[model samples]
Target: MKKNKLEVIPLIDDFSQWLAEADKSDNTIKTYRAVLNQFHEWLLSEGMDLNHLKKKDVQQYITYLESQNKSLATVEKAFATISMFARFLKKLDVVQDIKRKQKDKKNQEAPDSLTLDECNHLLAEVKKRRQPS
Candidate 1:
């Protein structure tokens, strides 16, 4: 009998499993999986092997996501998930520190934006309260 083999993408599932076994909540695991799945999709498009990934690759991906108008926090979260996955694979320092854009040079207020998930949850709550049925 022939068996199917999975490469890096399937690792998202493995990492999710690890997170579950580590007692992470379902919501947390779901968020991690979504973030990692996006990264895996990017890797597939780039045709790069996980074993040969470098810090620059991580930076480029972040840049690509940002170019698409993604918020800084989302980019940061992607970096974080990739870094954690790298650590799980024993690939230390594969991700680099992404610098904040200097849009507000006058007074640098640290980023304090809610993630997409939080925004959606808030909207859902607002909708629930609006419907008095």
Candidate 2:
């Protein structure tokens, strides 16, 4: 009997096995698997497949994570998982030149501000604090 093979969307189990063979800790393998599963789901929503992953898709994912207000550490970890998966899929050679970098607040845009009413109330409080007793 022959086992079924999927050309598209590489199996997470296979990747997990590869990671284990590479001496990655069980916790690391589990974390990578979870991250990959999330990426797979995001790809499905975006009408993409892992077999056809591209640099832009990865960037878009990072943007999506940021939009969802995911912590920087979470985003970086996800990127690392994707980078490792790209290396694992060397034959396909997708997601080239995606380098991880230290996140800088100066490079990032300012976060969205509160609504007008909230800002006004905050200003009023600041003004009250400025007054002496």
Go through the candidates in order and give each one's C-alpha lDDT. 0.74, 0.80
Candidate 2 stretches greater than 4 Å from native: 1-10, 91-102, 105-133
> Which residue pairs collide, candidate 2?
none
**Predicted structure with the largest lDDT when compared to the true one:** 2
Model 1, residue 22: what's the lDDT?
84
Model 2, 20-132: lDDT tens digits are 99999999999998899898878877877676678888988988988898988998999889989888877334556554446786878988889999999999999999999
TM-scores for candidates 1 onward, in order: 0.65, 0.65
RMSD of each: 11.3, 10.0
The true-versus-predicted C-alpha distance at residue 99 of model 2, in Å, is: 8.1
Off by over 4 Å in 1: 1-6, 98-133
Report the C-alpha displacement of residue 12, candidate 1, in angstroms: 1.6
lDDT of 1 by residue, 84-124 (tens): 77877777677646543434565676778999999999999
